[model samples]
Target: MADQIDDVDFALAAYRTDGEWVVAELTHDHLEDVDVLSAALRRFPGDTGTLGLVAIDEDFFVIVRVAGTSTRLLLSDVTAADEWELAASVLDFLRLPDPEDDDEPEPAGEVGLLADLGVPAATMAELIDDEDLYPDELLSEVARRIGFGELFDDVVGLTSA
Candidate 1:
């Protein structure tokens, strides 16, 4: 799985501390698997919880949220499990079946995970349903909706300037 880590475009952890949002880069060491990524998210201190956003191979994105002993996950494309180990791991973690070859791209897991934070599940669904947006762009929209667009862009080197 070490070789798979190189395919990650970016991994970041965002959370609130002292009523302010903090966005920071997450190491690539655990980027290829869901278990270690959840463990890494648990290490961050946050009033609500930690949000883990990872874009892989420019193909799909995964969102993992950790609060105390509770963890939630969302995979941008279920079909990605066919090609990505990380996406497959996420399906395993979520106790979901592996997507079939003929299955259309659809989001899997807790799409409403960010509801309390701001973005609704419906909006998340809409974003995932858009075929034109890449995984990074989808994640960027998520970060923007949750109030950390600029900070997220800065951390992921997506800043225009």
Candidate 2:
């Protein structure tokens, strides 16, 4: 069987508009396939459009954003995805091969992809430096920096709320 996403542990779609946050209408099954996930992202409506947040088996998080024909990503721990179907499918979509035995979970793609949107890359590095934070916790920091801390926390159930 093809790699799937419903096997994913936690997934959510959210967008910010005119200073307010809104959770998009997410149909989980339709996005079970990577191609479909990409398609839905591109279809998301707005200027700073929709954002996809997923945490797989508490091992790592995948953030996906699309602008026109270009899609950007932030995969936490490329190695963690190796053992999970959802993470593997995302890695496949990004055209990355599985990691070797000596690999460590590191950020793949442009870490500054959301800098202009307000989540800075340097700040992310500091958070990951601890090496003990889970995918959701790291994402909480992202949401916090981007002005949606409370909202994202409520949706994702972050403890800092």
Candidate 3:
């Protein structure tokens, strides 16, 4: 697992359990910190589930975990523009559902999964204002699309109204 973790850049602490790849935690000194990215890579244990990154430029990174295997691309060489492009590509690749599907789904209501992820209500509201946090319906669609089914499944239990 440790050896597998050493292969990526920008990976910060990963672990595997019951054949599920879990990126336990990650930290970045700055949006573009290389050492932090290196540390992140070193922390990966091996791919079994999925590797997800909430990048600075609205970019999301995904890795398919498999033991002793490199199932994803290295992040070290990606430019900011590329990262955003990759993020969009990944989201599209995963076939995340669109927010506009089915009459917009009532503005996602208030009980959103992002809130469950510990994003402050005020902050989330602000993000929504800026169109950063997708509407609830779209968010759910995206969550399922991004291989966060487990996390999304547990969202109701994790959030507080």
Candidate 4:
């Protein structure tokens, strides 16, 4: 399981520009760095509004949005912070501590990461409320709500939410 943890299957990024959504590829090895991710998003060739999506070992996921110097994050599983380097880095970014065995996945520093963008964190919390859905499915629902569901599914080859 530890060896498999290093092989992540999805690392995609996109940003809205002039009412258009643009995508760019991100390497799996660099998922732990906000600066690298932010830099990549900033170079997306348009306005600075950028959002990132990444999954690890199909066990957990991350959503990051960057605007100016402020970066926001949402992690699918907070317990992952204790095991995965990527999750640990995310918690570090938000100044959160690793959780105990019974801990639930919740927003650490802020709950409304996407509230300003129209998708409320409360709504997102309700979406992932079901533990049965994988990170991709939860993210799929997120894309659907934000009007990029088809594009996201097409790019990621996932059809169901």
Candidate 5:
């Protein structure tokens, strides 16, 4: 699973402080498990909460939002649980059943996680449903919607300059 853990393309924690969005790179160690990731996120001070955006192997992504003691999660592709330890851990954390080999790839968890922020669940669903885009791209869109596209793009190297 160490090899798979290393497959993380990027892991970031984003939050709003004094009405401004702050994006920071998360340590790879936090990528080992969902609980650890959540705990790590809580350390960040934010007006709303902390969002952990993790893209793995360019195959799928996991979004975790932590506020106080509450944590909401989203997995871009549930089927990824079959082969990824991190994905599987997300399912376990959510108390969701593991995906079968025949199960279709779909997101799991609260799509409305960012509803109160501005990006409705419908918009998030549209992004997640587009199979052609990579996890980083989808995450970039989310950041863009929430007011930090440039910062996110710069961190992920999606922007040229």
Candidate 6:
């Protein structure tokens, strides 16, 4: 089987309105796939515009076009023959943020807080048993009533536990 990309190894490379590149490492348990990332760029606030995969190192770098600008990122640090380092160097040449930096938070707005919440399996089961409430409606109502962030936290906590 092919080795799966770990969550910590992936970082999001997006562009800012000032033409600067932004690299935010993903901290979630699972890494976002290309399709999901593309969707996120479309939904980002302030008309940042769409994102497209431009180039890949075939080892580490996965360069993308965002809002008509090209941005590259180090997708992993497991260098077999300096490929990861070379990708990082290229990213540096492009003035992107270092993936090693933990100062910046992960990219937001794609997976809503509900997905992150740890709702209990039993609670979910009970909620599902309610014939009057669809799962989507229940989630939406929960999101609306207690705030999406809180709902996500609760769901995440419940599920993870």
Top candidate on lDDT is: 5
Global lDDT scores for all candidate models: 0.88, 0.70, 0.34, 0.74, 0.91, 0.34
Candidate 1 per-residue lDDT over residues 1-161, each given as its tens digit? 57687788998999999999999898888675888998998888899899999898988899999999898999998999988888999999999999997998888999998998888999999988888988878888888888888898888878522
Pairs in clash, predicted candidate 1: none
Query: What TM-score quantifies how close candidate 4 is to the native fold?
Result: 0.86
Best-first order by TM-score: 5, 1, 4, 2, 3, 6
Q: Decide which is better by lDDT, 2 or 5.
A: 5
Task: Write model 2 residue lDDT over 69-112, tens digit each, in one string.
Answer: 76777777778666765566677878888888899767776678
Which residue runs of candidate 2 sit more than 4 Å off their true CA positions?
A: 1-7, 25-27
* Tens-digit per-residue lDDT, 112-133, candidate 6: 2223234444454444345575
State model 6's lDDT. Answer: 0.34
**TM-scores, each model vs. reference:** 0.95, 0.82, 0.32, 0.86, 0.96, 0.27
Q: What lDDT tens digits, residue by residue, belong to model 5 across residues 1-161? A: 57766688999999999999999999888988899999999999989789999999999999999999999999989999999998999899999999988999999998888988778999999998998888988889888888888999999999632
Measured by TM-score, how close is model 2 to the native structure? 0.82
Number of the candidate with higher lDDT, 2 or 4: 4
Q: Report the alpha-carbon TM-score of model 3 versus the true structure.
A: 0.32
Clashing pairs in 6: 117-152, 117-155, 117-156, 118-154, 118-155, 118-156, 118-157, 118-158, 119-155
Off by over 4 Å in 1: none
TM-score of 5: 0.96
User: In model 4, what lDDT does residue 147 have?
Assistant: 69
Pairs of residues clashing in candidate 2: none
lDDT ranking, high to low: 5, 1, 4, 2, 3, 6
Candidate 5 deviates by what RMSD? Answer: 1.4
RMSD of each: 1.5, 2.6, 13.0, 2.5, 1.4, 15.5
